[model samples]
Structures are given as C-alpha cells and as structure tokens.
Target: MSEIWFRTGEATVFASEGQATDAMPEVVIGSVKGPVGTAFASMLGQTVGHTRMFILRDCNQQVRPAAIMTSKATITNSAYVGLLGGVVQAALADAIVDAVANGVIPKDIVNDIAMIVTVWLDPRTAKDENLDQKELYKNNYEAMTTALTRAMNQEPTIDELIANRKTIRHYSLEGLDIE
Candidate 1:
C-alpha cells in the first residue's frame, strides 16, 4: 500500500521508512462536490516523493511568493558623476529644444544659448543646498533678461553671457518646504 502523510500549518510531518497507509485511522466527511474537492481528488494520484501541496481555505489568507535577495554591485564616484553629467546634459538639451519650439528663445541662437547655458549651469558646479524650482527659475529669468539687454545694447560673446549668469539661491519669506 502507498504511504500517506498529512500536514497542517507550519508543522513538520515525519514518516518511517516502508510505512503503510493501513496504520492511519480513516477520516470520513460528507461529499465534497466543489472545485476544491475536484482539485484534491485529481492531486491524490499524481503526488510523488516529498511533494508539497497547499490548500488555502480562508478568504482572508494571503500567500506571498518567496524572493531571493542578492547584493548589488558598487559604483565608483567617477561612474556616478558620469551618469549625473549625462542626465544633466539630456535635461538641458530638452529644455533648450522646448524653449526654441515654444518661441521662448530664438531658433537661430538656440545652439549657442544652449552651449552657454550648459557651461554656466554645469551639474558638477557647486549650488546652494536649499535651491528649489522657483528660485532656479527666478535666477534663470534674471540671467536671461540681463543677457538679452546686453545683446540688444551691444553684441556680447557667449563667454560674456556665461560670465554674467546669475547665481541660484533659495529665498523665502515664510518657512516652508518647496517640494
């Protein structure tokens, strides 16, 4: 006769070698005619050595899939800085493209303006710790106004505009977080 093992909860079931099913007491219940009964009956003939089956009865029961944890590789400072540079460049390019497309800036000087802006606002440069979007936009607007005025009065090189760019800083009347 085939051996049968029953388990419940988190308990372990131990069975002796060459165990017979006749040693266990018969368990009888009313006919189970639902999907669960069908699945259980189908599983009885297919179970092999040390097979495990879970039957969840409670509607509130939750089963979480097991996960294997792995260690992530370390990144060097130079590599991290490189990634930041790429991100900054992409953001600057996108902003320049949007500005030109929206007619905020002239299309003819977009590349030159982009270059000057990139040099002036390098991500590697030190910035105020508390600077936020409003402060950054304000500073940029001020810088652009100054550059445009200079260009209108007298033609200044890109280097001059870069040198005349405004510094970004946080300024608020009431104490509050910007983000």
Candidate 2:
C-alpha cells in the first residue's frame, strides 16, 4: 500500500516511489454548507417518529405480566410516559430545526431550547388539564427556569417572563404565537 499526501489549495501529486495502484477509489468526505432553511427542512422532513411505537411497546412489556401483576392504572401511566416522551422529543426537534433555519447559532441552541421548553411547561401558561395533572408541570417549570437562568447568566426580568407566559398561552389557545 502507498501513502497519499494532501496539500491545501494544491493539486494532489504522486511521488515517483508512490505510484497510484488499481485499488478502490478513495472516498473523500467533505463538509456541506448551504442555506440553513433548506438543511433544516430536509431534516425535519425525514421519518422521525418511528421510535414512538418501540418506546410504547417497551413500556408495555416492562409493566405487563409481572409475578405480582401490574394494575391497569400502572400500565396506563407507563404508556402515557412513553407517549409523552415521544411527543416532547418531536416538538423539540421541530423547534430546533426552525431555530437553526432562523440563524440561531449552534452553540446557543440548547439554551434556546431550554427557554422554549420552560415556556411550554410553565404552569402559569399551561392550558386545560395538562398542567393540573399532579405536580409534573410545576416540577418541570422549576427545573427549566433554573436551567434557563443559569444559561443566561442572570434571571430574566419579570416583564420578560410575563411576556413569554402570555405568548405561550396565546400559542396554545390560538395557533402559533404571533410575536
């Protein structure tokens, strides 16, 4: 086997001693750069929901036919958790794609997503019984808020928080929040 040398902005040349042989063609991998919108649209268009079924099935398998036998409510709750996880994953993926398309930096995507989930899980803005079903909403609210504050390096102002709350409520009641 002969070694190949690469030079930047220069054509690859074979050394006298290192002649190219009839081997498999070299596979060169290159970075792709393009319009963020196109890339995001392509990613979001792919089949991303197939894991939901697997997750639900795993949950069912774990909770069913135990020696002691699981209650119907226990099984139901397990299914709900799996379903909810899938939903949240899908929602976050969509949000991230949109954010990237809109020029959000890759480094800041996590914080942006944290802020988004915080708003979605805020009890003050939660609509219907989603937030009323136990303290899940409250717990998520506290955790996400803390994460957002830490990421921001400072606590968000009251007006800013209220605006986010209102925006989320409007988004739930009306279609997308217009702001």
Candidate 3:
C-alpha cells in the first residue's frame, strides 16, 4: 500500500534455547533483480555434503516471499541433513510467512523480494536423541523472526550502535581483558 521502503537488508540473529540447538540465521533480503537474486540463483549449484534448498512451510508449499536456505556448516551426516532440511527448514519458512502476516516484511513486495538465509544448526543436535525437536524449531523460529525484523528495519541504527559500542562485548571474547 505504501511506498517500498526497503531495497536491501541483512542481519544476523543468534537465539539460544537448546544447547547445541542454538539457532543463528544470517539473512539478506532484496529484489529478485538485484545481487541477492544473483546469489540465490547461483547457490542452487552448491551440492557438496551440504546443498542449498528452498525454504518450505510444508510438503508442497514454499513461503510467499520465496526464500532459499543454506547451511553454515558442511552437512556430512545424514541425520544432520534430516534435521536441517526438516525442522530447521520449517522454522525459517514459518517465520518468513509470519513476518509478512505481522508486517515485519511488507506483504506488498512478497513476490518481488527474495530472502537468502544462511543458517547454523549445531551438529550435536543430530547425534543427540534427547534433544527436543520443538526446542529446535522454537529456537530457529525466534532467530529467523528477529533477524528478519532487524534487517527490514535497518536496526542497530546509528545512534543505537554509537550508544552501545562500548557496553557490548563480542561474544567470542568473553573472558579476555581490554589489555
């Protein structure tokens, strides 16, 4: 209904719910005629241990915005493949559709916009039978929605970044001092 406000967006969200089942999604959204589209089309050729695939909400239904998903880790194990292509995939697709429904991703550009999501699904989850599939789903869903919202809004705006620059420590540097 309104003028298109977002031409390109990208963000990464890490959601922690399950150990080894923490979800991290790095998302890029843009027009099909842009670079995101080029990467989306070209990623189809990657068929190593892990391959790229479309994000589907169900057996025959892909999400409206038309998204592709790739793995951050090389998927060598069949079990890991199943988890990624199954639960994680569904989580992401649902998140995208809900984003549209909730106005995080505008409904007007569903056809023109394409999403490329690079997901990290921990390898440990595949080997651990006790790990809950629901937890995995919830984790990814939270991550996907948060990532999409952040990207679409161009979040961590200049002021937000400037204010929090010194307060937030890089996750990787948990214990080391500034010295």
Point to the candidate with the largest lDDT: 3
lDDT for each residue of candidate 1 in 1-179, tens digit (9 for 90 to 100): 10112111111111223321011111111112433233345544422321212211123321111001110112234433332233322333333344346554455532221111211232322232432433333333344333333332343455766776553223442465443
**For model 2, how does the per-residue alpha-carbon lDDT over 23-101 read when each residue is reduced to its tens digit?**
1111111112223223323333314322121111133432110101011112223344432344322333332333334
Model 3 ranges with Cα > 4 A deviation: 1-18
How do all models score by TM-score? 0.24, 0.23, 0.90
Q: How do the candidates rank by lDDT, highest first?
A: 3, 1, 2
lDDT, residue 164, model 2: 87
By TM-score, the better pick of 1 and 3 is 3
lDDT-best of 1 and 3: 3
**Higher-ranked by TM-score: 2 or 3:** 3
- Candidate 1: TM-score? 0.24
lDDT minimum window of 10 residues, candidate 2: 63-72
> Scored by Cα lDDT, where does model 3 land?
0.82
| Model 3 lDDT at residue 129 | 66
lDDT values of the candidates?
Answer: 0.28, 0.26, 0.82
